[model samples]
Target: MEALGWFLFAYQVFVLYYFAVLNFLYTTFTFFGLNMVARYARELSELSLKDLLEREAYLPVSILVPTYNEEKTIAASVRSFLALRYPEFEVIVVADGPKDRTLEVLKEAFALVEVDWVYRRALPTKPIRAVYRSLAHPNLLVVDKENGGKADALNAGLNFARYPLFCAVDADSLLDPEALLRASRLFLEDERVLAVGGTIRPLNGARVRGGVVEELRLPRGFLEKMQIIEYARAFFLGRAGWSAMDALLIISGAFGIFRREEALRVGGYRTDTVGEDMELVVRLHRKAREAGRDYRVLYTPDPICYTEVPSDWATLRRQRNRWHRGLWEVLLAHRAMLFNPRYGRLGFVALPYFLFFEALGPVVEVLGYALL
Candidate 1:
């Protein structure tokens, strides 16, 4: 028993040491990524707004919003999207068979009328009951589909999307009016860029008017405030670092833009995983590298999306559990790329970093606490 105790103690120490080193590396990567984003944003912003607008190169985008019992915030969210400043775009809201008045609220709010539209299955999904077009908002379409989780619902949205670029957002999230225009510009500017992810901020305490965030204020609640700091550290430091190295793995689902053909060719969103967003990104990198294609998956800081963070510990825990599980699922699904030479930086550095630090860091911390 004494020997076993010593073994456990040594194991805990080892895990703690590993955790520290991994965190240091993550911090390093984050610093680099953040600098890259800052420079990119500055350069992008320097371009005259008139020139950007008159570039004669607006790419049509389809915004896919997947909702499940989001009645409380659905109207505001949809209204926000409708007000986007893009020249051409469509919003597809997939009502994932909500038990509440979600569908009814949308129908009445948007003056939706059932429309006969043709869609082909790009990814396997639950049965879609009906598709509706809003007479009020000409570009808005809503689909009533069976509850098949967020991933499945997004796949359903992808099947019905008509644009060359598709963006997936949550029903409770609100995006900046120019977010899409800023993020999608990279795809147009660089033919090799495959996808672009934007920075996400917490929207808990922001003042809202006409479904747009009128002001940015720190939340009064401790939890919300902590998330605000967390988001700042994440986007300003973490994602920026990863983007610098071109090893960005997960783009926030709240606001990410992808080439429609590339997304479809890579099998769209995976239905079996809760971390479909991250999984799809990893697959994009894997496929691109495998095909010997020169491509870039980028993260930009200018396009901002604000999402509601859970205010309570219970809901927060549930969200974290789902996210951690999803990370594990994605890692397991692509275990083949772990240190595989062909994937270059992704295989050697990025994948291993996620496997060690992001995925296993919690377990290491827990064991350290147990030992103490």
Candidate 2:
């Protein structure tokens, strides 16, 4: 009985220590993030962003939309992409074998016609059924393909992507008119930038006109309001902090731009994992570090993508499950980079921080709650 009491006391002490450490690290990150956000704000204010747009200095991008059963939002999302303020861009929508009428709706809405275009299969993916070019929008292309999954669909779109730069976005998302211009400018400014992640805002209760979000408003759902606050904290602070240290690991799959050549070189998206976005970003970091290349994967707060957040408990639970699973998968898969000095800040700091605090955080939280 005495030994058990001693053991329980030790466990309690450990939990307290863990709780304090975890919160301290997060608070540190929050401070760093706020500083970075302020720096970005100043940079944007001083920089002549319009000069890049007017002079057409931004790189061309192929926007890849991997859709499963998004019949309702596919057309509007494509319209949003088409209306982007960038000088040169193309929208590639991949219908990943939806049982619903996603393909038919896209065809009817956009006047899509079959087109034979040659593409290099740099990465293997599910077979493409047909490629369609929209008569109504010249910059729009659609791919009908087998049901592989999000990663597989993105691979198919990658194969069909024509430009050197490509942006991956969720089908149920909408980008700001200058989103491409803002994200692509990072690539132009820095030769070493391999990927750029944009901020994502919830799209509920916003006044959208012609596929563009004209006015922002708070959603009626309590869950969505909670998420809006969460997003503001994560993107504005956490992501900016990571970017400041050049240790950003995860770029939200909802909106991110990558160099096609670097992504292809790394064998494209790994289809086995649901956290394909983070997996790809981590892989890029690993490859660049191993190759002794001076490279950066960045997160910018200006380029915004609006996505619908889960408004109910069940949907939110599923989303959180997938996220945690993905985090574990990426952490385990690249365990070699955990603390090796060779990978610099990534292996020494970022990888360890994620593994200890983020990945194992839930376990610690549960232990603390139970003990309390």
lDDT winner: 2
lDDT per residue for candidate 2 within 123-158, as digits (tens), equals 898888899999988999999999999999999999
RMSD in order of candidates: 1.8, 1.4
Off by over 4 Å in 2: none
Give the alpha carbon lDDT tens digit for every residue of 1-372 in model 1. 899899997896787789688778867977797678668757776354447778767799999999999888899999999999888999999999999999999998999999888988877889989999999999999999999989889989999999999999999999999998889888888999999999999998889998999998888889999988888888877787888888989898888999999998999888889899999999999999999999998988889999999899999999999999999999999999999999999999899988888888788778768766
Task: TM-score each candidate.
Answer: 0.95, 0.97
The list of candidate 1 runs beyond 4 A from truth reads 1-16
Lowest-scoring 10 consecutive residues by lDDT in candidate 2?
45-54
Kindly provide the TM-score of model 1 when superposed on the true structure, using C-alpha atoms.
Answer: 0.95
Go through the candidates in order and give the clash count of each. 4, 0
